[model samples]
Target: MRFIPSLFTLAVCSSFSIQADNAETAIERITVQGDLRQQSLQQLAGSIAVVSEQDAKRTSAQHLDDLLNQFANVNFSAGASRGRYIQMRGIGERSEFVDTINPSVGILIDGIDYSGLGITGISDMAQLEVFRGPEASRFGANALAGMLNLTTKGPTATPEGKLSATLANYDSRQLAAQFSNSVNSQLGYSLALEQQSSDGFIDNTYLNRDDTNNIDEFSGRFKVNYHPTERLALQFIAHLSDQDNGYDAFSLDRNRNTLSDEPGQDKIRSKALALNADYSGLGFADFNGQISWLTADSDYGFDEDWSYVGIHPDEYATTDRYLRAREQITLDYRLVSTPAGQLGGSDWVLGLYVAGKDYDLNRQFWNWDLWQADSFSSSLERSNAAVYGELTTPLNASWSLVSGMRLERYADIYSDSSGNAIKNHDMMWGANVSLNYQVNNQALIYLLAARGYKAGGVNGDALAKAADGNLTELNSKASFKPETLYNAEFGVKGSALDQSITARVAAFYMWRDDMQVKGWLNPDSGPQFAGFIDNAGSGRNYGIEMENRLQLHPQLALFLSASWLKTRLGNYITLDGDNLSGREQAQAPRFQYSVASDWYITDALTFNLSLQGKDAFFYSDGHNARSKRYELLNARISYQLANWELAAWTRNALDKDIGVRGFYFGNDPRDGYEPHVYEQLSEPRRVGVTASYQF
Candidate 1:
């Protein structure tokens, strides 16, 4: 609370000392793709943040997680080798086990879905947009909380190429290169490749290995654009990624040291292809279509007991592993009416979407000390079809009305090695309505109401269901109910000081019914735990967000963003007789903010500094454990000279102990079944230097 006043004071004081100058350029027009259409940022009704390629380079961001963590109301759970799970406004999943999960947030890269597996390479990205509310009408069930859209650099008519290399502490090395050009007047192409490796920041004393938790990644992307005729355009894109990383992170004493004998692996290999086409031959409307396919194979395993065999001779030491392979295909087609007055001064869009997914999982549990092994496998196939439409009409000179709706049908089939089969079907719907009023050329205000939906799925843990000893009970618990969200928001966007300053503020409230929540259950009084998903009664989340950018001078700029969130359960009760009606939702922080400043010392030199902070929050619903509030500092310096650039950067410059993930459960036998809090810390201070050349 005290920090809020200080931040405002600093902003006010800085404004007084800064003078506006036309010599410096301000970011006046930002184009964003939020609803499958490009719209100016100032005209958007919802809360969104955009990170450009220049910003990513200034911060020396190597992955999507690095660029996203600097924004307000955005956080990640890092139980794996990297930040694979994202939480927006405190609504997202932290981890996944045997049970199937419907992600609250959706991730898209060049129109291909990568929901739970967002480890795709982010090199040479043109821009990234983060939508902070339910995008129901645009994305349907996959975007209950929000969405992230990443656009890669497109092909250019002029030939150009870039090569860069980086070296950092802890034996880290990275190399990247890209080339784009036009082969002829009608065709253009682009290619990019990147490889990075590091001896990660963890020490395993038991195994005497300093590089037990290493990171190795490789990625490549190719894009081609062809304009066959004056009214037709076509594009093809392909991407491939391979990540092989270690996961020995936890320590008994909650520090940077581990004693696990069987360190685990977190690996993923993915390939994706997309084709897009547009035709404007019809004078009444424009047609656009996209076809995409993605496949990924992953192996995630971890040490069940973070200890050596001799530490607890009587207790069993185990390792749990899961191998998963997934394939997805999608087709989308839309037609947009051209000319505002084509249909009585109104604009409209109609779209059809279809998607199919196949997922297979194999789990293996090895009790090394006890010489026992258990194995299980499951497969799931899901299909979805939807039709959506939106209409925008002007009510008067200053007010406009927009309405949209989506109707979708989903079906899923699940089967496991235990001879259990489950089939389910659901019909989901989403809608949105908004009213916009333009106060002036420099300001706009809007109110929006939207609904979002997610389909349910069958539980994949066949062994746990069989252990219930009742076939009827097992069948009844096989499926969970769908979840829905209703959200309302009011927002304002404007610019001042001759467009030298731009700001946006929004407040939103969301009510969720039949909320899907995850928890672990103990079928018997043993050390084993079975994961399950069930529908809670209801929940609510309300929050306010503000973002501002000030171009103090041509050589200096300042940026600030903050959010305050509150979440609570309503009439929700756990299976263990715990009344969580009034309890706060897990991972819901009270406040989060970020401040950054950039200074150009000279025509060839620049410096940057940033600060990010987050308030304490609960870890999960099953436990009352909480994480401590923390802040991080980062700095960067760069020098440019005629097609060559050199930069140095440091992350976590202050070396703060920030917890990225946490758990509250018993794992060590020496503690005699006493539950304690365990946390995974973020990376320590890392210093690196990069050099790049463009031609």
Candidate 2:
């Protein structure tokens, strides 16, 4: 897949930027820790994107999932909506049981890791940053494929608040309020609350299930900063949130428009605290340290008799519980602008990281006074120390070369509820090099290559016990191996026609060794399948990405992005000697394209429109019964009066019937059932109004 944007397109975009605003004026820019001279998104040698607060307001995004779904390179898994489980560039959440993510993509909120679905949603975020390629060489080990970084709003100097109320067509009503205050010269605080209720879109096929869903959320954040002196400061942050909401409907048959009797429900809670301190201009080095902790708990339930026709009325309830907690601490020392040495002007960084987590899960069926519980528990601890440095040397007036490397060690252990134990230890190395040539101030081209890795572990749920003994170990079903990726890319980023427009294009090839696949098999207790982690033989992913942003006069702007991917797997052999060749990776569409446009109209009135399209994807490894291609269109209209703004928006305006359904490990065609037993449908035409104020 090769993408080449014509010069005519560039010229047209440049003409539209004649009355544009400064790109960095509305953003809070921060330096990339290791490379202080490189631009945040434009000059970096990796794929990166940033979402501004202004953009969020234009879209009226009330939550993190709304923002993620609008991005081109991102794909959301159709699940129960406890929270969004995402797949980026073909990797993430490969399993349906126990809410297990693929472990290749890393998610962080305010620099704190959110390991599971319990803590994935951030209710009051200010901005979200996504790095598309292998950022692990700079961010961490877990970001083998990419990274998602979330930033929350901090306390401001304002001392006012606003209240809003809304009503919609879907039997929906909403109310929200926000307040901000400055406690003193050094302390600031902000608080927010929201409540929403709706009568769902589908009918509950079973009895005794809730047809109306309601959600109430509360969030508060506090910050205290001491700028007692310049160049040295300390900041403290604390955040808390609670959410309770009813699950959306999942269709059992798309052709028949049948819904489940047991509509899922969820209860979720989360909290986080962190402290950061920094000192610059030290005689020898600069020092920075941060420590943070987060915890989440969730409860989910579904009806067991929703599908069976003749089951007793008493056997109508079933449920699952997933709980997770995580903590992390980090410290770093960097030597900048060293004096009188061979490495003068070069940067060096040494860091130490320590983290730990615990996971608990249980599932059961509810029949009058009879309860069966299948439980699993595991613990994880990790300690890593690394030293990394980058050096750039000038070859000529038009060329320069940069090189860097990092070395680290990792160790982990997994213990199940039955006392069975598995441990792993390994030392890994990662490195990168790039050659950059300056074509002019408006253009630059670079070629780079790098390697990334993800730690391996045993299936936390693949344990069996014997009745005669306290615990027994079953032979490991799959010899899971560490996943490693090697990537080579060539790209260009630049601003043209006097910085009125910006554009980027890149082409790359990435290969995965020992990939992990969640092979599904029908279980005895229910109709759904459980995820069994196995080592996929081998696979290759190659793609091209293109993005453009143009300012069509002062109050108008436009953005466009597209991705083309070609992925294949081979050597996948099951215990039965069956081979999986010519199979497409799950949830990875071959072609995706997106475009968005905005018209300010006036300072008081704004209009926005966006569109996204994706090609068909194979839900099963056999490349049979693939999902149909789909497209979604969204529009927004806003009007401002003094300090308040009112907006109306519609999502999925076309009401396209989108479905993500397929057979897992084997095909199931019941006599009276359809080809796909159960399928999750994307939300249909949704319309809402919102009001916001700033003081």
**What does candidate 2's lDDT look like per residue over 587-662, in tens digits?**
7788787778889899899999988788887665543556779887889998999988888998778988665444
lDDT score for residue 602 of model 2: 91
Candidate 2: segments with Cα more than 4 A from true spot: 1-38, 95-102, 118-124, 157-201, 208-217, 255-263, 308-342, 365-374, 378-398, 438-443, 465-479, 523-530, 575-578, 620-625, 660-677
Report RMSD for candidate 1. 3.4
For model 1, how does the per-residue alpha-carbon lDDT over 283-387 read when each residue is reduced to its tens digit? Answer: 888889999999999999988888889987556578899999999999999998889325788888899999999999998986322458987789989999999
Deviation of model 2 at 671, angstroms: 3.8
| Candidate 2 lDDT score at position 495 | 64
In model 2, residue pairs whose N, Cα or C atoms come closer than 3 Å (at least 3 residues apart or on different chains), thus clashing, are 206-261
How does candidate 2 fare on TM-score? 0.85
Model 1 lDDT on a 0 to 1 scale: 0.82
